[model samples]
Target: MAERPRTLYDKIWDDHLVHEQEDGACLIYIDRHLVHEVTSPQAFEGLRVSGRKVRSPERTLAVVDHNVPTTDRSKPIEDPESKAQVEQLAINAAEFGVEYYNEHDARQGVVHIVGPEQGFTLPGSTIVCGDSHTSTHGAFGALAHGIGTSEVEHVLATQTLIQKKAANMLVRVDGRLAEGATAKDIILAIIGEIGTAGGTGHVIEYAGEAIRDLSIEGRMTVCNMSIEGGARAGLVAPDEKTYAYLRGRPKAPQGEMFDAACRYWDSLRSDEGAHYDRIITLDAASLPPTLTWGTSPEDVAPITGAVPTPDSVANPAKRAAIARALDYMGLKGGEKLTDIAIDRVFIGSCTNGRIEDLRAAAAMIAGKKVSERVNAMVVPGSGLVKAQAEAEGLDKIFLAAGFEWREPGCSMCLAMNPDRLAPGERCASTSNRNFEGRQGYKGRTHLVSPAMAAAAAIAGHFVDVRSWR
Candidate 1:
């Protein structure tokens, strides 16, 4: 008799199963748990009510990010909502004995960014954060996901997650991406091709030459949106790049432990004959710095593509989505994507908030100042990235080019940080999500690669950077 073959997703999940509940769900161990201000308060309070302690406080890490102002994080936050969330996180971390990385910790950023920087995420582990982009940790070859507030509460009480096994979906992007086509572009293009709802009930594993060549941050950018692709999680096989990225991080293994861990990580790659339930391939040469002309990331088109005419949409459900996206974006169908002017330029987020992203934007903006009509800013993902960029003079290049060189944090990514668009202003953003009012009241967002955002900052419109490059 032949035994059922196990896909990589199943292998990882089965390795972590702590117990199976009566309802047919398995409670799996979470090797690393990352927490942010907005979601942890209620969960910690739930523990207080139940008189339960964190199942493993050492495995948990906390940060004050979503609710803190990025521009002036050194001072007390003014918004009562923001202050309460940030302060409550301080209290909760203290009560529960979880290590808290506060606003000026030099390690703070988006919780997703901080987790990897802290080396808490490792290969072959299962990680969970209360935030959706927890999938970002999958870049390190982990089975990770964002859970609900209640699930966060449950994990804190039990150190395990009740989850259903997901099918495996292999997404292989082959060949070399041309110079200006970045990780952000590759992801936006994939979402545009697969639609926003394509990978439901599945776990995605990225492969192929282009994906293999991406830096840790670039890999993180793609994996960060596996959820946006409707996948439960995403994984990239551990390789030299993954090992190199984790080499000297705070919590990563050291000396003998590091070498031994590498041996285990070496075994985490998909087998030569590994099986996946579904597979999709993309040509890297086909990508360019892209943008979402409408609403969802799936509403994206290469900067060269026109705003889709609703009547021309092929899918009935997608046609309605196209129409709604156009309406919310204040654009008419069949409009030229290039003619959609931009009022602001944002170049940072967990999605595109690393030194390489800043370097790409700087490379495009050097000797070219931002258009007078466009207000632009660059926010680094962490104090570390900010410092590294400054040492390379990228900050001066941006400031001299007329863009504001802001502090380190998730500025303007979600309007939770001090940076934001003025009412009714339109922006070309490197951040994820193009939801109406995502940046502020009535502010419109068009997600783009950092290089594209830089080109738009100078052109003051959504112009394709492949041409500019």
Candidate 2:
């Protein structure tokens, strides 16, 4: 006789369910589809071979990011493979009649960034891309995650995804964050506690006072790394801040329509009595400026801590993994994190390339020079973010601080483009993932927040950002 209580994930899931099978597989409509160069070529080709037109061309948007050069766009792309992928995306987009933003378009950026910037990612929508970081869109209370190339083709042809429901997990962070601690630190801290497989088969909904306090951009940073934590997706309930962030964007509903949308978004939260499959809580104030000393996101320690020894892990397999990671990272057991030097600093990716990230890094490096021993660069998440940073003079501050101001793209986040590390070159990176060869062949990556990456650029090693002047 009573309405059933449901989690945010359940609410969105039920809203999008089109058909359910006996084994629990469902056909769920995809509201927003973000496309990039690397993964969609095959999907697009599948459509061509089958003579399948995109069911909802207007709902799909494509852009070039992963394979675009972060350097001079005035010149033609030099790498043959990169050139082909970029060109093919343009061709595919034209043939399919899907809206596209090319390398030179002002709207061009990492698909994850462009989606939210243009208001294409909306609360209560089901968004998908072929890239792992598609989880980033969940920041707006959407049910979003990455899909495979086959799934991409399926969505392009049908505007629906085959899916199974994921259990709901809650990651609640209480108390205010410490000074110099950021949303990046919060997420890295979470991965440290949960390990890589912690959120397997679940969707994590981040709640509590600390999560509420984060700006939408910060929330995006957290959700962007949900893949690193093994979560199917991550979500935060829509609130006034979420509504405010979407209000003036181009694709968002405007004026009275926006007011009506807000009314629906307001109910996007979990009911008071909803249950979670698992719950994890953290004391935000206790989190320090954290960094990953090994190859995995979970191999994290506070900046003030030391590299963990293999023996510190009780499980033999985990201990062996720790040893392998430390060896790959060029870190010795018990070495202080601050004592490890870095040769490069990368301050961009879908993870930490927003305008706010740029502003934070710029504020930290203002009137200060990057260490002569370290080569550093800043790549904005999108061309729009680049323009915004320049408008606010953040670009000048970074240039004056001796950090290269790179064009927008997924620069140095992976080895896809020209921005990469030489073998054995250690880097302090703001991007997500530090897996073997993530940045380049045998490159060593230490993941940090934008400010911490900037600080490392200046100090040439990890430092307690909380103590930075």
Candidate 3:
């Protein structure tokens, strides 16, 4: 019999399967487990109460990011709850014998960023974290996703998880991207086309000329938002870009071992005739700088467009939802996107906080002052990213441009840290979500690429970045 053709997700899933139940649930072995301060405390406590030892301490890595302050790390964490979460992760990592990166450690950063930076995420492996952005690891061709706290404890005790296989979906973007458009725009466009429930039961595998052209960092940005699209996870097949990114990392295989690893990674792509449950094709060249207008990631439109009217939507429920979102966003129907002035701008997150993202934003705003009406800041994804940005003078450019160059952490991405928006403040942000109060109490977020955010910061309003001079 001929060998069965399989997708990247299928191949990885089968390789990790330990058992299959009649109800369609499967026992899958998790090769990598990433823990962080926010979700691991209760998991560790659970282990302590039950007296269960971590099955594979060496395979797990812990870091502090979500609740860490972005200013003056020397001072103690000001938020009592944040301080407790950070301190508890340290105690848990030590007690469980897991490798840890504390706030003072240079390697410490967002869990997703730290994983790929250290090469702990690899092709053809199952990776899980207690954070939704764990899908970021799938960019390297790993089967990765977020799990609840209970599942986190389960994985710690057994190094395995119970899951039902998700359908395979293909999102292919062909042709060259227009100038000023980026991986962030591509993803935003996808969610806009498919809506939030589009990938609810699927594992989306991104492939095509546009996806292939993206650097590993770009791919990471795309996969990082997979959760916002309502997908189980998203991935890109491992190729030269993936191997090159992993070649010399601290935890990646060395020299001859790396060569052998590359050979295996080469076979991690979907077979030529593999079947997909669904497929979505896009013309990358047609995609413009995209942005989210409403609270949901699905509420997106191109930069050249105007705010949509709720009356334009036929569905009453959807129309009401759009009305509510518009009211909250302080936007009126039919207003030009560029007419929407912003009070703040934030350029950083697991989605766009990489070095490349910083460089792009810096280049766009170099020698230009931020709008006097706008308060803007840039936060690097990791401590290492922060160091690299400073070494290349990216920090100088941002500081000179009137943007705050923050210390590394998940600052402004969510309300877990001090970096946040004031009530009713409208911001052009590069972070993933723009949900109500995601940044702060009643804060309004409009998701855009780093370059677009930088442009908006300078203009004090949304501008078509492609035409910005």
Instruction: Give TM per candidate.
Output: 0.96, 0.99, 0.99
The digit string of per-residue lDDT tens for model 3 on 183-276 reads: 9999999999999899999999999999999999999999999899999999999999899999999999999999999999898989999999
Ranking by lDDT: 2, 3, 1
Candidate 1 backbone collisions, by pair: none
Residue 459's lDDT in candidate 1: 87
lDDT per residue (tens digit) for residues 336-455 in model 1: 889988899999888988889999999988999899889999988887888889999999999999998876666787877567877878999998888877888778999988888999
Steric clash pairs (candidate 2):
none
- Model 3 misplacement above 4 A: none
The lDDT, on a scale of 0 to 1, for candidate 3 is: 0.95
Residue-wise C-alpha lDDT for candidate 2, range 1-469, written one tens digit per residue:
8889999999999999999999999999999999999999999999999999999999999999998999889999999999999999999999999999999999999999999999999999999999999999999999999999999999999999999999999999999998999999999999999989999999999999999999999999999999899999999999999999999999999999999999999999999989999999999999999999988999899989999999998999989998999889877799999999999999999999999999989878888999989999999999999999999999899999999999999989999999999999999999999999999999999999999999999998888988888
Off by over 4 Å in 1: 1-5, 21-23, 314-317
How many clashes in each candidate? 0, 0, 0
Instruction: Give the distance in Å from residue 52's predicted Cα in candidate 1 to where it truly belongs.
Output: 1.4
- TM-score for predicted model 2 compared with the true structure: 0.99
